[model samples]
Target: MPPLPPVKASDSRAARLVLLVTAIGLISLNLRPALTSPGPLLSEIMREFGIDTALAGGVTGISLICLGVFGAAAPRLARRFGPERVILALLVVLAAGIALRGTGSFGALIGGMILAGLGIGVIQVLLPGIVKRDFARHAGTMTGLYTMNLCLGAAIGAGLAIPLEQTLGSWRLSLAAWALPALAAAIIWLPQAFVRQSPAPRAARPGRLWRDPLAWAVTCFMGLQSCLAYMMIGLMPLILEQRGDDSARAGLITAIAIAPQALTALAVPHFAARMRNQSAVAIVSIAVSAIGFLGLLFAPPSTALLFAVIEGLGLGATIGIAILFIVLRAPDSHVATDLSGMSQSVGYIIAALGPIVAGLLRDAGGNWVLPAAFFLAVASLNAVAGWYAGRDAHVLQDPES
Candidate 1:
């Protein structure tokens, strides 16, 4: 009959915070696998379904389209049910989508991807606002963490798809394995939905985000960079295979390009947050990314590994900076939700075009050169938009607003 010593309040609070962050990170780990896993397996899936590259690209494009469409719905759902509960529910949906793809039919496969995108898009829109709401002081660092995990998940999917296929003897089984992690994250996040959150401060209404030039700049930066990012994810492995690498080797190379994303994804936001404005960081990231893309396109196939790593570093930094702008520029969680929804909604829709266009270009020219040139133009525009969006000004600062 002994009583345990009472736990300290500060200690308990710290433990809970750590648990919340872990939950958030775990949830972020589910965001990209569905999008990237199918990349390495695209050729196999296309063969099984008797589809062309354009149709293959449509799978990624479909998800991005759903991502855009659902992104706009996230804030509304959050306002009604709270972000935590909505996220938890959507994780189940995501898991179901992942498993549905395992049915080994093209209809189920495409249907599953659309469901997964619905889960991913809303969860993504809501997370920035939660970070801003709960971890406002460390928004940049936390955003870096979020994005780092997101990229890491993508690398895992791209890197392991072929091996998993070999081990399991079917690509369907490999894709279905991701469902386990989605469910695990949902279990870890169970407690968060019940914890009451601090109320967000009432913020002055900015004019419609669509009407704000600063908001548009942020959207453009996010969209264009995401366009480039998705383009590479959708096409890189295929490009390598066409250049003569085997499926496994191509997947490994694609994974190598994505793995380094974690480093810059963590570093860029931390660095940008300390500066007066993020323009230098944003513009520099864009330049490095463009250089890497061009190198991969024009250099000997022998150089793919080196260029892949370079591309990852720059791409990771760009994504981190894009998300950081959303948290930093918005004055409150409410505004952050609205801005996040707007930026990602429009941005991902624009992003969807990248894969489809690249596919069409390849079909027309019988090579990747046209797609490469198109992406170069996209990167050039991303640089300009990032500079404007990176300025140290709030989206609501206009007097008329």
Candidate 2:
């Protein structure tokens, strides 16, 4: 290993910075399609495998659980292999897993999803640290850009899955198509792997994150918001279908709900950076989401499109706020990594329960009303957690205190 050159502050350097950020953005675009594409194709998958809706939902739950559990291990892996290398390796893993999803066996499909989920989990945890380190002066902008790519990926996956399935003659081919983007990301990221070879690793602070109130606040907010998002992803189409909307219309509604995220995802982090306190924004975002849930639950079928847009706005803003808290609450980059690990690890584990429980409610009583109520409860909690996490204060203990 050797010392790396410093990032020069020059016009040419700025141009290179733009290119590097674009590459990273493309990599972010590969993270979510596999997980989300399944939702739109849930009925096709169930029919093909002769499985129930709960079982289909369980598959998503298992993937999410693996995401959380494996996400905790990412920082350690990054420390060992370097963040760039870990990212490249995970991209390969994601590509292979996604490509294998066309195998059509139930076990193979679940295994593929788990592997893809693990890759996505690791990337999600590591990319923020990479942005923080490489774009220190522009972390907020870079984070927003990367997150926008994530939303774009989700929207594209949700929007195009059915059409691709129709053209390819099976859901398996539609699912496997996501691997191409993952492969492209790997190719683009390869040059970055050795660019900063001897960079000093941040030392780990000795503290129990679970005991920190701010950490718990961020965790709870992340979990609760994710619960709402995943519930919509897994069950919204079915709910819409029950109201006499066809599958295509339901898919389109889901796409609309997610598409506005691309704009809000880019906007929230940048705006939050200018605010002295993010609590107001957080409260408003979650409240908006709660109202969106109510709209879906109680509004007439003709108004579903309007509700989708409202929900999408809230979802987009909540994601941005969650990531903003990661940077705003932590004292330094190392603490950001630790806090991210804690928040996402615990948050996702809690989030993984949403779909499973929603499925159970749907199965037991055959109604979406109870699950809709559950989403509202989660949204209320998200508001409270966001208020605390979005406060203008740090979570790390002051050494002199």
Candidate 3:
């Protein structure tokens, strides 16, 4: 028999690329759902388990800390098992985590969240590298799509939690339903692990990342913006409830705010890429979000949804810009990898503090004003950091290295 023709091989490669992109999209859709779903149902979770506000906040904090710590380990896992395999394995674990969380025991809930967080962290760390490898010329577009889907997923997760609970008659069941999507994503991703694998790139040296002022600026911006984002996800529903909204209504309100993020998330990166610098965009986005927070704090309950929309749009753009900075400021792929590791690992750990603080303030003062003030302060700092990071300059290189 004649060997396969070159044209057919090329077509086969094309087909595989399409499948891989599909897999990436499906996986991205799942990342935020697991992270954000608990927020809308958090009140119920707390009541069911008799957990306090701070401990409820600690749920998000626990997951975030795992995201930071396990993310640092993901690159190593990918290198050992291959990126595709690691991702596939992680998806399965994510499914298991989501399922275990529905067991209704506090220990199971926390254990499940830890596993889910680790899975998400590892996959998040590896995805940009995968995009660069597979969609090099179109990395920006692919990443924009990924970010947009992440926002959409968050919106859906937050919005659906209450409705799902009402329909299913159990909050546990509602949470467990998310496992289906994770399983579906895993099935779609399975074929990629069998594809030809490349040797992992050399590990980046950490010395330069530590010395670079610009990298530090970028990291701060990333962390600060993440602080606001996590606060919105973990605390917004509760805040709205404090302002006199019911549980399901508060969840939908948070969903509406996050839903607009999909729009800005899709648009910001593309337009930012065309600009000379992204400083203005970054400032504008954070300012808009901060204003929303102020309104939520001071304005009447009638205006909450309007402020949420404003906040969501700004937040969507803020994060899009933050992720863009990781790619835009890096001098090369190795540097991008190191920058991503530093920003997400350190940044998310910093972000983890936001929810904990919000929870503590809620417990201490029993009001949203202090929490809103905390967010305002963080946003201000993020704006300053963003201004520096968004300047059209690469990270400063080390000398005598």
Cα lDDT tens digits, model 3, 89-174, are 99999999999988878888889889888888888777777766667666567767878888998999899999988998988888
* Residue 311 lDDT in candidate 3: 90
The candidate that wins on TM-score is 1
Q: Model 2 over residues 1-401: C-alpha lDDT tens digits? A: 99988766796667766767877888888887887888878877787889876887877787788778988887778777777788889999999989888887988889998899889888888777767667777767877888788888888888888888889998899989999999999988877776644253464452565677888898888888878778877777777877887878778888888888888889988888788888889889888877876787679988988988898888888888887787777776777777777778778888888888988887887777787777878887888998888888887665543
Candidate 1 Cα misplacement greater than 4 A, ranges = 1-3, 197-207
Kindly list the per-residue Cα lDDT of model 1 for residues 199-287, writing each as its tens digit. Answer: 53343353466788999999999999999999989988899999889999999999999899999999899888988899989999998
Backbone steric clashes in candidate 3, count: 0
lDDT for each candidate structure: 0.90, 0.81, 0.85
RMSD per model, one decimal: 1.6, 3.8, 2.3
Evaluation by lDDT, superior candidate among 2 and 3: 3
Worst 10 residues of 2 by lDDT: 197-206
Q: Against the hidden reference, what TM-scores do the models get? A: 0.97, 0.94, 0.94
Give candidate 2 regions above 4 Å deviation: 1-12, 198-200
